[model samples]
Target: MAKGDDLDPKGLIEESYKIEGISTAECRSIFLDWALSYQGVSAVGIAALLARHGLGTDHHPMTITLREGLLAPHAPKRRGGRRGRVVD
Candidate 1:
């Protein structure tokens, strides 16, 4: 459960912050990769990473993405399809 390896094993989040004028879309793509790479990381862990990496830049794309990820629902949302939309 090391911070560096566990939270952001690929260092995508860290690198995204380093890119000057990075776009929200790019951050989102990097975030998705980070999330899929390190599944099951708790919200608290994410908060720590945010605190460490997101320091004073509220407008930072990575910071915004991380905050959004935190706010996102834990349960997977059902997609739009007859089978998916049908209530059991």
Candidate 2:
């Protein structure tokens, strides 16, 4: 895999790949950290990170997490709650 880039400033994604038999949940946590640490837009960062890593159906947890992140919705939907009912 390519060296950690600005998208993964903490090297969380790179280290996640090194972890053998890492669970998807763990990867998700790492991805969250990576996402929070990254300054640029997530889609752009994720795409660049994937390209740098040269991943293709490797079934690696990090790969799965990155792909899932891409597929995930951009806008977070509000679940039914008091906050959801609040209005200006």
Candidate 3:
């Protein structure tokens, strides 16, 4: 994972926000791609990066969706079940 200055040299996040009429779903996809590419960066870090680049998610619906998607808690997996049945 790239750090500090190396985070997004390609400016993908900026481009995503520049697209006219882009939807929240599209932003989510773009955000996912961006996040996945930066292995060491946390979601909060990404948000801060976007903000520093003038694409803050706070006022934008699409960006807000991306932020929420990144920060949303993961669902817990069930430990022993095929539809909750015991394996014995």
Candidate 4:
């Protein structure tokens, strides 16, 4: 096993989300996608996170991650230059 596999799970999950090319929104999205990508969180585990978020099994959906919430309008804006900063 990799050195990190033995780490505390919360720390490992946080570290995995920090790996290069893994953005916060992608991490949030993959929390759902994770169901398919690997052995994945247990059905019980998925149920727990969903319940913690007040998501009903029947209809609630994942909200945008913090970064996505901040950046959505910028999806159409040009990259680079000084306009990047949100003005007061």
Candidate 5:
């Protein structure tokens, strides 16, 4: 059996704050939007996030990836290899 209880956005935001690639504010805002929009699909669950994404949004949202011109914070920590290494 599963326990159905209230969800806390602040708690989740605090936890996500330790992670890279996003700030706590963005994480929290995105999460809240997901929660409010995906009402019937078990709020605060990972499944809800997928469902919300599939439904789409008003904003022209793009991923925080190379295509969007956002370099990942941890990307530079890795040693360059011959595959895509810069050379003079």
Candidate 6:
């Protein structure tokens, strides 16, 4: 994927390092926002792109979050009836 198409178009990861007192919690929040922004993309692809940009290392919270997001399975939706039931 192109850099412009990345979840972090503004390079927030790089910019975060420059901030004087950025906390891990804040970074985690930012990472979540970035990850959620690109629902159309796969977690693997996103992680790879982030790694290339230097934000996908184990040392970073962003990377950890990305990995967790990738591994987490989607929850199955619950239907209201047992097997099949007519609404009428």
What's the lDDT of the predicted structure labeled candidate 1? 0.81
**Over the stretch 1-82, how does candidate 1's per-residue lDDT look in tens digits?**
2235667887777778779999999999988877777766558667977988988988998899889989968897677889
- Measured against the true structure, the TM-scores of the candidates, in listed sequence, are 0.72, 0.73, 0.61, 0.25, 0.26, 0.50
Which model scores highest in TM-score? Answer: 2
What's the lDDT for all of these models? 0.81, 0.81, 0.64, 0.41, 0.39, 0.61
* Per-residue lDDT over 1-88 for candidate 3, one digit per residue giving the tens place of the 0 to 100 score: 2223456555666676667877777777767776677656566656666566544446664567655756669899877758568556
Evaluation by TM-score, superior candidate among 1 and 4: 1
- Backbone clashes counted, model 3: 0
Candidate 2 stretches with Cα past 4 Å from truth are: 1-4, 54-57, 72-88
Worst 10 residues of 4 by lDDT: 1-10
RMSD (Cα, Å) of model 2 = 3.9
Q: Model 5, range 1-88, lDDT digits (tens) per residue?
A: 2323334233442234334656435755655554564435432354333333323422323222111222224555656688558666
Predicted candidate 2 versus true structure: per-residue lDDT over 39-74, tens digit per residue: 999999988878866456468878877888889678
Model 3 TM-score, all chains together: 0.61
Candidate 2 lowest-lDDT run of ten = 52-61
Q: Which stretches of candidate 3 lie over 4 Å from their true place?
A: 1-5, 53-57, 77-88
Best by lDDT: 2
Alpha-carbon error at 4 in model 6, in Å?
A: 6.1
Tens digit of lDDT per residue, candidate 6, span 2-52? 244455665665565556666778877767666666555766656665666
> Candidate 6 overall Cα lDDT vs. reference?
0.61
| RMSD after Cα superposition, model 5 | 12.1
